[model samples]
Target: MASQPEQRSKVARRALLGTALCAGLVATLLTTGPARADHRDDAWTVSAPAAHEPTAHIRLDDTTGTVSLSVTRRGRTVIEPSPVGIVTEQADLSEGLRFLHRKDRLVDERYRAKSGKRLDRRVRMNETRLSFATPTGARLDLVVRASADGVAYRYVLPGGYGAVLGETSAFNLPPDASAWLGAYRVDNEGQFAQYTAATAPTGEYSDQALFETDGGYTLLAESDLTGDYSGARLAHDQGTGTYRIELADDRVQADGPLATPWRAMVTGDLATVTRSTFTDDLAPASKVPDGSWIKPGTVLWTWLAGGREAGQSLAAQKAYVDYAAERNWPYEAVDAGWYFKAGEWDTTDPDWQTNSWMPELVDYARAKGVGIIVWIHQRELDTPEERAQWLPTLERWGVKGVKIDFMDSEAQPMLRWYDAVLAETAAHHLMVDFHGSTLPKGIQRTWPHVMTLEGVAGEEKRTNTAAHLTTLPFTRNVIGSMDFTPGAFQRVGLRPNSDAAEVGLTVAYESGLQMFAGTPESYDRRPLARAYFDQVPAAWDDTRLLTGRPGREAVLARRGGDRWFLGGVYAGAARTAEVPLTVGPGRWLVETVEDGADGLVRNRRVLRGGDTFAVEVVANGGFAGIACRWRPGVTTCHR
Candidate 1:
């Protein structure tokens, strides 16, 4: 997340990645950057469900005060313990801590998502507790929450500890294990790529580092971050042959009643991990009393149709407003040049008058049924007074949201600043899209108004390849909605995707701010496909991963209202695929827009639960469809 002074450079530095923005402390850690205890035993194992046969085990080693983990599906150990260790200023969890008690319980609950891929969210897990006490009188609770899909554990500081020194939860994988390392060292939001477990880089991280073994897969991520705590990244430990998690900085003083973010590792099939709601399940409930004002919809961006030459002009913006109105798109962005060109950094500047025209544009967009969203550099929102002055004006003008960009740092202070902006914006009933941001750790669950983030190598990266498209759905987008700015129907080299892949991408990405990155003319060329694009909503009632292999191929199903949308995309090879229909028990009418021998074609059929339909995708191509309960006018045959 870049500041106002660096907006230009930040935009120019178009590396990919994004998520919700938070603020707390703002300091940088060393570019290069944890303890040892031994916990290796199968005896400490426990299954996800008490009544079922155990497939995986979490072994706690009291012998050396450490831990080890494994999954039977993979045969060998998945985690060899980068030596189960936790470091702090006044105490080392590894040393002088004795097992005090142990307990286990079954948890089954459900919650609704303020805005998410699914409305009916469920949590089914068997929790295990292991209490430890330090000779220094500091106590810690090691809690593990296990579900059929995966497992997550966190350190609960019961008391008697000093500032956090970080933890040493390194992952030791089997020989054949490979991982999708999202190495943070890669300049910006690092892209995820496959590497042999041992060959994967050490001392780097992608916020959600995904490791796949012959057994299935395990997703390692941090969640539910609260006050005075540091975000963590992985650091490779050569001596231990594992990737140790290092909190952002050195041992900073941590207040009591603190629990480290869940050191979560979910093991399951690719689809299970992809569809897991663990991130949102980890966050605190929404603070907004009434979030009905928050919404998800498609937006039109003028930058695509008008470039730098026409982008900032009143006439070009009006054209975008016209386009949005014509397409029934809900919002239009007045990106980067309404207020000082650099945005409302200091209203005292002579250029402040330039923002006077914003009221007029907002009025025009509103008359056309399109809400306006303006852009501002993160620094412009650094102060409450500044936000009070700026956002109120936008809200008064009936603006729906703001694209706050260039929040280029991830320090604690920066994190706090992000929260401040979100809170301030929510109060005014304006939504947000964070650009030049970090990964989402269920902040959308906490702040429903935060629509999306720019933490993935999305269409904006003119340098991205076809492979980038296949990698994002599993890695960066896994945690939550991202501001990928998808919907490009041009050539792969030009940073757009094939028209065949366009519809799939539209349904594939979940964002409150759903906008395309291509020219209006380019999108207009595919009128048939536009039917799905125009009607599809950004948020969903449910999501289903029918079949997929990260970066290889994916068949996804999502529900919105009574309609179910399906999309299938593949990497570099053409292949036949089958998608199990997830519609309710009743027979449903299905409409498909998929690749045909000559060109893309539309087909209709009737299908029901447990039935699989054939879908064919070309190399670097995709297919899309929609299904819903039978209607009289729509063609449907007996199933």
Candidate 2:
């Protein structure tokens, strides 16, 4: 019942394996088996053993010597033929190459996560590597991986040293595909917008661009971006429906055998795409000696309300600490200008205020069961010498965390600096939150002490639109922890979304260091909203996108311990969202806070799994709630 081509393929595989065994290559046989050489078209196929898993096809053009790739999932095309190669300062590795050999194996790795959407993660996939030699005899390898959720590939240059000019990596989508992407910026603060393949802006775009194609959904993103290469952006070619990888800087260096970051196409349905951990899976394992010290919880910040003055004033910081202690929040962040004047990073300056009351404030907060997070500019502590001098000092003062701000660069040097700083900070048992920084490339996995990063159009800008808020879950926030600094309840100023939606963002946004920016008095005015934030956690054990449409609405359920926190946000028009109760089987007491046409309203009810919980959400409105397993004595749930 086998076709002619299938018979030849079987013979080739058997012959290749027999030869490898005869050659006494037991290590290679166990890990990589043998490379099946196809004389027909010089193309190799790698797919997950499961029928539902994704499949990738790689081809090396004999005539042009260019490598191209295509992918399919569940018998549907996820990516068309797309060119993938890198350009170095020495040779044109993109074309005019000769095939040398190939190797492949299946990788199934499971690791425990300290703080993320999932507590435990498994990276199960089939990996194939194709080696080629350039005209100048430079060796390069194209490693492709196909998993249950997506396809990922990267270029590895052996014995590479010097400058890497650029990359020819691109994603070719269907002509009719639509995309939700954020514009590329150093700080990555642009709002996401929608566009058809042909109408997408030709400018640069940030990571994690979600596309809706005829076959299924595909999320374009990158991972494992280290100091060896520059941070990359997507440059669109509308006519060809292609988005090419463009390096952030021209001076990308490769000091050794260089391995480019994985360019991933996360493919499947919306839920599959949203739940995919392929990005984090591609990153290196945790480097922290012990992640138990890195606690995740709510933080009270003062910069949003009173700016630098409040963060510098001792009394204001103490008051904020008292409020955090009273609310049982874990941390209070005293932002920039804590011990130095604005634009004055040099501690040697005569007016550096060396005798400030930071030690007293830290002691005060520590006694009240609260920790202090101090802010410092990038210039003050960029080098190893500076970090070595300051990290131990902060630890001595009982500082629990540090907020490093104004990085504003993603060049190769800056990327390396991030890694070094995280290592040094971890040595001192202090967590890190990067502000005005580059987008997260799954670095939190490698450094568990990295709590969050400000790489989005967060609440501080005071220009957040409802559409932007709704789009983040499916776009920016999916890659890693995003520091949106949600829960700003101030009524004055040009606030666009509803009060309920603003309150709901504390749950909607995923951040290890979830900062509630509202002042104590402002939170006192809305006790119901404050009470919701009082109990909701910053990190989660499990996450599910109950229902979502980018730039329209996103309803999510995140579980912490036995309690599940639910959040939803809508844009454009008023509508009724049907939130399915899919937590599990059993009776659950659901307490919800939603938009009440006049303001925020709270309601409680008992529901079972597979029930449809209907909500009346107004234009640009949102909702937040809690759900707990019901027992005979369980009468009330946290609101």
lDDT winner among the candidates?
A: 2
404-447 in candidate 2: lDDT tens per residue? 99988888888999878878899999999999998777788888
Which lDDT tens digits does candidate 1 get at residues 370-426?
888888777777888778778887788788888888776655566668778878899
Using alpha carbons, what is the TM-score of model 2? 0.92
What RMSD value applies to candidate 1? 9.0
What's each prediction's TM-score?
A: 0.85, 0.92
- Alpha carbon lDDT at 403, candidate 1: 87
The clash count for each model shown is 29, 0
Which one is best on TM-score?
Answer: 2
Q: Mark the regions of model 1 whose C-alpha exceeds 4 Å error after superposition.
A: 1-63, 67-82, 103-108, 158-161, 185-188, 237-241, 308-311, 341-355, 490-492, 576-586, 595-600, 606-611, 630-633, 636-639
